[model samples]
Target chain A: MDFSLTDDQRMMQESLSRTLAEASSLDRVRKFAADPADRGADVWAALTDFGLPGIVIGEEYGGLGLTLLDAALMAEALGRAVTPVPYLGAVLAPLALRLAGSVEQQARWLPKLASGQVTAAVAISEAVAGARDGAGLMASDGKLSGKALFVADGHAADLLIVADTGGVLHLVDGTANGLGREIMTGIDLTRRMAELTFDKVAAEPLTGDAGALARLRDAGWVLLAADTLGACDVMIEKAVAYAKERKQFGRVIGSFQAVKHLCAEMAAELEPCRSLVWYAGYAFDAAPQESSLVAAHAKAHLSEVSRFIARTATEVHGGMGITDLLGLHFWFKRVGLNRQLLGGPERVRALAAQMQGLTG
Target chain B: MDLRLSPDMEAFRDQVRGFLGQHKDRYASGAGAERPREAAMEWQALLIDNGYAARTIPKAYGGYGAEPDILKSRIIAEEFTAAGAPRGFANQGISMLVPTLLEVGSEEQKIRWISPTLRGETVWCQGYSEPGAGSDLANLQTKGVEDGEDFLISGQKIWTSTAAQADMIFCLVRTEPQAPKHDGISYILFPMTTPGIEVRPLKTMTGSAEFNEVFFTDVRVPQSAVVGGRGRGWFVANATLKHERGMLGDPNATEARFAALIDLMKSETVDGQRLIDNPVMADRLMQLQARVMTMKFNGLRTLTASITGEAAGLAGMVVKLQGCELNHQIAALAIDALGELGVLYEDGPHLRAKGGWQRNYMFDLGLIIGGGTAQIQKNIISERGLGMPREPKLAVA
Candidate 1:
């Protein structure tokens, strides 16, 4: 009857957090964000050393074989540092493969993906859910065509797992003959997105049914929620630290009830979200019957609450919050992008309503 | 991360279900309606005797005397709530004062107070908040001047719920005039019917007089009535306040209310369509569902932390603030779903759910303010939980 992280889970988070703190500092993140070619190679190497990319890959495939909860923890650490590395893809690609891939397919890519020899990105927008600009992909006759937009960490991947219009997942080589990839400048530079065009590119369909795709979507929601939780935590800490040192009217602004309440409100609203994300992640593994609904709830609720925390935490900083030099915008924009990445709060809530049989 | 109950705990749940099944008719008759006091007391005593209530208190104090097991306690609460059975008495006496007595009371005080409170033989009202000392409770000027072996208490306490019906009151009073505000106080207990005591019912927005303005004018009680010693009332009251906050923000109550809201949405119709079927209403319901689920999981996390002896920190601190606000939002949404029917009060012919939603909407507002205003809770969360600087003290003129 426990609903908390195991000691080993806590240690894993701490180790990853320590590694990110050293390897993905704000300067390093800025450097990566500013450079079009860097692609956070150094940060990815750090994560590889920490064995993060394979946290959820099957042990038989030369990977760690951990649960979605472990992967969610890694996502949280990445979000906390706002590290400019390709983690969302690193986690989700393996998850989709494991959930839907054939044994042969798993054996082919799992080891490379685990060892960071190959990086993968997922293109599910307009497939399992709606995309902002009606972006989509189509598959036929062992070939993929059409465009997939908002592909997270897509520009520099060695492999691409694209979901078709019918919610079928297909694996495509990044360097396929007819494939084209273009970077899409997004608000969050910590994690990049891309637009992929597939023109008769050869692809292999995952053997499993749509249930795997749905499970993969649920995992995505939980991971996004976990990431939002970590981002909110850092934003609140940054705001509190700033308020403690920033003086106004002859005293630390933190001593003012207004500033204190702002910090307090952020903490209050975000604290419970930790449990929500944890439960959603736990449900993904242990309570499959409830996973989809809980994941939707976590995603929608955190999307709303994280916006409040982000905006309010920034407001707590007054003018410095808007300045690029303060770098609060990194977290601010990270949360902004997370809010809309898979599905914003409204879309997610609508899906949850449908799942509950409340919508026609 | 495991949420599965152990086989032993599962067996215990079956035992509870079996017991409730046998006595189901005894309490089920008045499931949602208010029961007669005598019948309620009988039901409470049966529960205490069966180790369902007061499960951890010693038998000498007329309790079940079981070891404290959080999972078992949660199981009992869940089964009892599910069965529509009254899970013994809950009030200022039982939830707040009893725990304080168990922690810091004299043996005599415990023996005299714990059993009756547990058995619903006595009801208590808290006398802590004053007109000038609400958020600043330490500024209370309720004086208890010593006269021989008794103290003559004089003060006014507002927002005292159930004061008009209470058998006794656990009160805070300043006993040392020269000492600092927080250090000069004492916590004392006395009969509500003591001399010079007056209770004026304070009708709230819910159109009921559940609370009162309790006036203590030269009320005399033995000095021995003081619990946890003199000059320690602040600390004792703080302990009881913790219990009070917990009582007000019960996740079980919120869950039950949310369930009722869903039922109402299903049953009520607008424009000949079920409220639950409306797109806008459904969206709102799902949003609230998300928050409600958060409260449930957060409660589990807190319970796990308690069992594992880990510091819950901010998670524990935000419950009252979040729970109260979420409950109020649920009730508000219920009323909104009712449409024009929402405006109907208890006396209205078309009133739905016996005006429960309306009453809850108003009553939950009082709850947000009563235990501690949302602002005070935010202060506590920020200052204590987040290590933010405290609000600076104002200079004396």
Candidate 2:
């Protein structure tokens, strides 16, 4: 009946957090956010050195062979630092391949993806779920066309795992002919997004069934929820620290009920999310039947709660919150972007209702 | 992160199921009927005898006296809730006062109070809040002047639930006027029939008098009635209040209510479409579903912390705040889903769920404010959990 992280999981999270703290300080994050040429090469290298990219990859494929729960913890660490890195795709691409890719395909790419020798981007949002702005991808006659928007870490990827209009996942080469990548500048500079234009570009389809796609979506939701949980934690911490030190009316602002309540509300809202995300991650591997529904719950709930924390934390910082010096907006924007990524709360709830047979 | 129970626990669950299967019908006949006091006492005694209730208290105290096992306790609760079996006695006496007495009461007090409380023979009501000491309870002015072996009590206690039916009252009184507010209090227990004690029902917005205001004018209790110690009542009361908060924020109750809500949504319709099929209502239901899941999982995490002896900290502190608010919201949403039928109470010919949702919506609001106001909870979370500074003391006038 144990429902807590194992000691090893805790140690792993602590180690990753320490590495991220040293590698992606606020100054480094700010500098990386401002520089167009910087692709967070250093931060990615630190994560790779820490074996994070391979945490969930198969041990047979030059990786640690950990579970999704471990990867979610790593995502949380990256979120706390708002580290400028390509982690979403690094984890999700391998997961999609592992879940649906052919044996030969897994043998070819798993080792490279696991060792950080190659970087991959995932483009599932437009075609599989939450399609918006007339954006989608289609595959026919061994060729891919149309556009996939909001491709996480698309710019520097050597490989792309994309879902087509029929919900079939395919592997595409980054430098394939007629494949065009246009970077979309989102408010959250910590992670980059791109719109990939596919004009009859060649793509090899994965052989798995629709269940694999659903699993990928569930994994994506859990990871995103974990990331939001991490970001909210940092925002609350920053707000509480600022309140303790910042003074108004001849005393520290934390002594005031209003400021204290703001911090308290944020904590109250976010503390539950930690367990929620952990349970979702645990369900991903240990409780397969409930995986999809729990994932949706985690995603939808955190999407709403993180927004509150982000806003309230920013308000706690007073005018300094808006200033670039505090870099509070990084977390705030990160939370904002997370709410809409991979489907917002409304769509996620709709999916949950449908899953429960509550809606047609 | 395994959630599966052990084989031993599973066997224990089956044992519980079998026990309930055999004995539940004894009390099932009285469901929805007015209080069947004798039958309830018999059922409580059966539970205590079977280790289904008072499982952790000592044998001398007339409990089952099993070793403390959180998982077994959880299993008992789940099985009882599932089978609709009577879960023995659960009142302020058993839930809050019994635990406090076990922790700090004298052997005489334990032998005298714990056994009867567990057996449903003794009903108790809390006497912490007064009109002046609702949130800032240390400011209580209920004086207990020492006179020989007894303390002469005089004060008013407000919002005392079950005061009318309670046979005993555990109270807080100011025993020392010159001492600091937090240090001048005493926790005393006495029979509700004590001379000069008055209980007047205070009708709530729910249109029922489940709570009351009790006046104590020269009500006398022996010095032995003071549990924990005389000037340490504040600390003892805090301990009991912790249990009170836990009781009010029970995830099991919320889960059951949520399940009932789903049933209502599925059974009720508007404009020839089921309410569950309505997109707006479905979305709202899913939102509540998320919160319900949060409460359940967070509860599991806290239980794990307890079993492992780890500090739950903020996770434990936020339960009452989140649970109470979420329960209120759930009831509010249920009413919204009820549509035109929502306004119908027990008297209406077309009343829904026997007007339970309407009653709960109003009662849950009281819950949020009663154990600790949401504002006070926030203060505690910020001050203790987050290590935020306390509000500075204002200069005394």
Candidate 3:
């Protein structure tokens, strides 16, 4: 069977990687983290030019009708560079909509999203942890209430793909009446999070079934898994290179067996993390039945593995791994933020076990 | 890029699966097909008869001549592994020697060896690790001195799996003593029945004599027996190792083993609660399943890398290590979760699932040690995969 990437997809990945490497390197990420409000409009426009936002939108929506795999490639690149764009919120949210959204909803919002003119965030997480079934948010009488905490790119978005108590998806304007936002200080600075308070705000349903909210949550989890996989790679590479260059005990610390073992563990964990992302990505694109389990596995594994890599990487760098000068912490923060985002490793692991039919 | 398989390939996978389904009753057995080598040999011959052996070999070399598709190969491996096929027996011959031959064997070599090896007419074992050269394989002292048309070899090789059963061997010997450690090595192929060869089986924790200590007292083989160039055996061996590690991605095989363990846990109660229902056991099984799935996915990523010809050095060194570690973990978890019943062997009256988990727990040490020690894999990734500096070798005065 042919598992190879098409030439266009390969070039897309290469150009995207090159752009991120040149314009939004770890150094650039560190700079952006210092000023989160300073959006990368030029870079975002470059991404639009690169068709990053339009890769998955249908041609009828003024975008390329690319598969989920294409979006995955871009997500991975963004993850590796720790690029501070709401690409996931902007791209993945729409892609999920196209997959599970209503026909009219697709007709209404797809073009604006495909043109990169609007950014959106999916509000699935509630005020408290482990609230799986639209825990705190309630939607009734064409009015939405309750709050969604840690709404990614919440403050910067033009729209919110809101999931209510009944699990229907609603496309709500960011400035809907009674909606308030409290910018939350998070471990990751490049990506902003906010506590969104919806005080009976006007809402519109995007998906009729509440079950689609689960799909949205699952898709979002897998995307984060993809992103964490990328961040893990960045941290691993940075730590390894740093170890090779930084000297201690009259020799490169890398030459020491202890350091060797440490980096090897990272490599070990990183490899599996990569595989999980791919399988989850493949499942997301191809197999629906296995996607939830695979996604949970990828997310849980990446959550733990990326954090382990970051921790080990920082240790390998000694004092410098923690500092902004090294820029390794950016990846570390990204991994941490991703880990805590939808459901932490504990939640995902529990879900994975249930999916595997191993629940007690 | 199209990650989807072509329709023909999909049909081919189905054909392979259909064939496996028809013949799975024959291959179904426990993991302990390690020694008494006849069972493995017979199984290998059956695979050859069915054209399921040496799957990656091209048609001219007595293989299916299928295109290099890692996913297809992965599916075949997973199906066969699920059927409890003897995977260890094929490790050296199918996984290592056959692939290396495809990469570097001469036309004469391919015609002479590849077909027979794939046909199971010639069983093979690897002779790489020695007592003193476990992780540092290049430090092996096995030497072959040239004498006219042949090379006289005299050395000792330890930890050679299937040595007693192997009819042929693909070994590395020191051909240039004065050269650097890596440079002096040569990969050689020879009949195990050659003069001066002795295979002494060594019993392990599994209570099986599966491995051997082979000694060669001036063994002679023709110059043409070398797989690649002389003094380049290190590279050939490395190539073989790479192939061996790549094919080790079927993590779902553990599913069956875990199934067997769960069955035992169902019948046997622990603390008045079913063992499978225990929170600790449940948590451990769940974690193991997650890790297994993670490893499976990692394998897919590496397969993608292999299919695309991207660099997979990191992928190879890491996934297998993780697999081995997970295997060990699952085995231990099975034992602990079994309570007192976990310690019994197959023949015991209190035997549970044929004492498979106990045997597997003991046998898994070899998996970590055979291809490369977990420590060595870590070192490789740290140094090569991660661009870390190499660890200094102990000074040889």
Q: Considering the two chains of model 1, state its CAPRI-style docking category.
A: high
Model 2: TM-score, first chain: 0.98
Candidate 3 chain B: worst 10 consecutive residues by lDDT? B28-37
In Å, residue A121's CA in model 2 sits off its true spot by 0.8
What CAPRI grade goes to candidate 2? high
Kindly report the TM-score of the first chain in candidate 3.
0.93
Taking the tens digit of each residue's C-alpha lDDT, what string does model 3 give over A196-287?
A: 88888998776555467666667777788888877788777777777777888788888898887988898787776665676676677688
lDDT of 2 by residue, A1-360 (tens): 998999999999999899988899999998888886788888888888999878888899989999988889888988898988888888888888888888999999999988888899889887545678888887889999999998888988999999888888999988899999988999998888899999999999987666777888898899889999999999999999999999999999999999999999999999988999999999999999999999999999999999899889989999998898888999999988888888989999999999888788
Q: Name the runs in model 1 displaced over 4 angstroms.
A: A131-134, B28-36
**Which model, 2 or 3, shows the larger TM-score?**
2
- Model 2: DockQ against the native? 0.90
User: What's the DockQ for every one of the candidates?
Assistant: 0.86, 0.90, 0.46
After superposition of all CA atoms, the RMSD between model 3 and the true structure is 4.3
Q: Model 3, DockQ value?
A: 0.46
lDDT of 2 by residue, B1-397 (tens): 8999999999999999999888756763222213337877787777778898889999999999899999999999999889877676778888899999999999999999999888877888899999999888899999999999999999999998888888999999999889999999998999999899999999989898878999999998899899999998999988878888888788999999999899999999888889998888999999999999998999999999999999999999999999999999999999999988997986667998888899999989999998889999999999999999999999989
Superposed on the true interface residues, model 3 gives a C-alpha RMSD in angstroms of 2.8
Tell me the TM-score of each prediction against the true structure: 0.97, 0.98, 0.85
Q: List the residue pairs that clash in candidate 1.
A: none
Q: Which stretches of candidate 3 lie over 4 Å from their true place?
A: A21-55, A92-106, A127-129, A132-135, B1-5, B10-50, B54-127, B142-155, B165-199, B215-283, B301-311, B392-396
Tens-digit per-residue lDDT, A77-124, candidate 1: 888999887777777888888888888888899999999889999888
